[model samples]
Target: MVVNVSNLSPRLRQLGLVAVLFGAIPAGLALMGGGYPFQVGITALIFVTLAVSLNLVTGTAGLLSLGHAGFFGVGAYAAALAATKLHWPFLLTLPLAGIVAAALGVIVALPTMRLISIYFAVATLGVGEMIHVSLLNWVSFTRGPMGIRSIPPIEILGLDLSGVIGGYYVAATVAALAIFAVHRLTHSYYGNALRSLREDDQCSAAMGLNPVRLKIEAFAVSCAIAGMAGAVYAHTASFISPDSFRFEESILILAMIVVGGLGSLPGAVIGAVLLIVLPEVLRGIGDFRMIAVGVFMFLSILFLPKGLLGEASAIGLARRQLGAAWRGDIGAGWK
Candidate 1:
């Protein structure tokens, strides 16, 4: 893997290493002092994971899914059912929730594989709403809007992760792994092919790539990752209701992906973190928080067209290009 990464452009390799280091900061903090408020960071980190995984499908594969929260809701309910009805442990329930969500993704992706752009997004929106409605109406399974309470704290071996501090560690570790997996996936051949399809689907198909299969696979993987986040959230919060997985959550996820920048893993992480933190940072404004959030989002888009991280990268590249030109390297200009 080191050799493969080394073969990339020096800038990309450096950027990747720097990103890995930055992503590990949460774990480093968890090893030291942390408190319940850290769970808010953990929730934000889960958003980071969800956004990165969704980037795989939307940013890389040119596939848009508005139904992602459906998968999240599914994972939450599945874990709840497992823990309460089946008497299964939370550990066992979480992964099962992921599996269930992945299976649903596969099912949804199969019929929608032929869709593109707006039609696909609209279809997913409807799908997400449908599931949410079912979750609300299905009192027997989801316990309806009344919700399930007293969700047992997750226990790994004999260690109870009942404390918010412990939950932060678990959440950070899980979020880190999820992001790393996305990073690895995006650098693999599969990622290359997905990007190719994103750039030009006809061209990719002409090159003998099964665009349908790839899109479906990306969709499934993205949903599976989101489901994992949702499952963890269920246990961490120890309570869930239909209102929890509302359509607004879907919008927030989309906003995170977009604000972070398209087709950039680090961008996704940045977006999730800022979007999560921005609201809290605006606490001084009280009733004006939402306005402040919108203004920040607008300025970020206007000033940094590519994204916060992407613009910083562009500056670095420009400096590198200037240095190369001064040194009389291969080219007088950089692309």
Candidate 2:
């Protein structure tokens, strides 16, 4: 009981911190009781998962993807179709959804390898829109606008997580795992390579890094995470439509990472929570809620250009500079 937490390995400390933070969300929700608040909490957790997954590509690897919603939708429909048509267990369909979406990510990455900057972003946008349209027209498979219905509640280990609090717990758990995985990724050697690829793909290639292969892997991993999030969303809501996964939705997700800090893991979670909560808190504003949200986002970018968490980092950097100066280490740079 008197353990020295500060002495723990960095990895263990990170795991402990993340577990406590995520665990608190559900615990707080449970204490607050259910209803609209409960639903909002669940929604926040879902987006936290999505934003974290998106960070794998956009944040770590610097791949701009306007088509993440497509991957999300793909995973949703994959699991939905599997559950509906094949009568597969919900647990089994989760990975199937990820695999299907990841395969699509790979296919998209193949063509994207040749493109860069806005072209690559545009390509991803096209890919997302294509997926959205295909879902709209593929009535035999997706049922088009009618969407997939009657998706059963998630059942795991003989316990059904169909209820409000149950679903929240499940989503929170998934979000926690996603955060931990992404944290590890951003701190790992592979993650370092991804950051290198993001900064200079050509230079990284010259240094023996395969830019194409790394980019593909990042896309595939990012999409797989998105797919899993979508599958969880589908089951939690018990239904889904093509409308939920759209270009605008993709933009919203992209905004989450930008406002959160492009390469910051905590930034993703913070951005998701703020964006998700702000909308609901402004629901009383009726039609003007989005306008308020847009204004808020505009201000965030204007003042905190590096992002909220990024701004904090900038402050920390300044403090570090001051500290070095105080320690008489500042003059070495000019030498």
Give lDDT tens digits, candidate 1, residues 1-335.
25664346656765665565444555555565666446667778778878887788887787777877888888888888788778788778878888998999999889988888899998888888988999999997788889888777788888887887667667776787887677657655677788889889989999999999988888888888888888788888889898878788888787787788777777888899899888876788899998888898888888877775663453344344335432444332322
Question: What TM-score does candidate 1 get on C-alpha atoms?
Answer: 0.84
Model 2: residues with Cα > 4 Å off, grouped in runs: 1-23, 311-335
Question: In lDDT terms, how accurate is model 2?
Answer: 0.83
- Poorest stretch of ten by lDDT in candidate 1: 326-335
Best TM-score goes to which candidate?
2
lDDT, candidates in the order shown: 0.78, 0.83
Off by over 4 Å in 1: 1-35, 311-335
lDDT of 2 by residue, 1-335 (tens): 89886466545765776666556666776677766677898788889988999988998898888888999999999988898889887789889988999999998899787799889999999999999999999998799999999998888878977888788777777787887677656655687788889899999999999999998988898898899888888888889999999999899999998899887777888899999999998999899999998998999999988887873473243234334332454422111
Q: Give the clashing residue pairs of candidate 1, or none.
A: none
Number of the predicted model whose lDDT against the real structure is largest: 2
Clashing pairs in 2: none
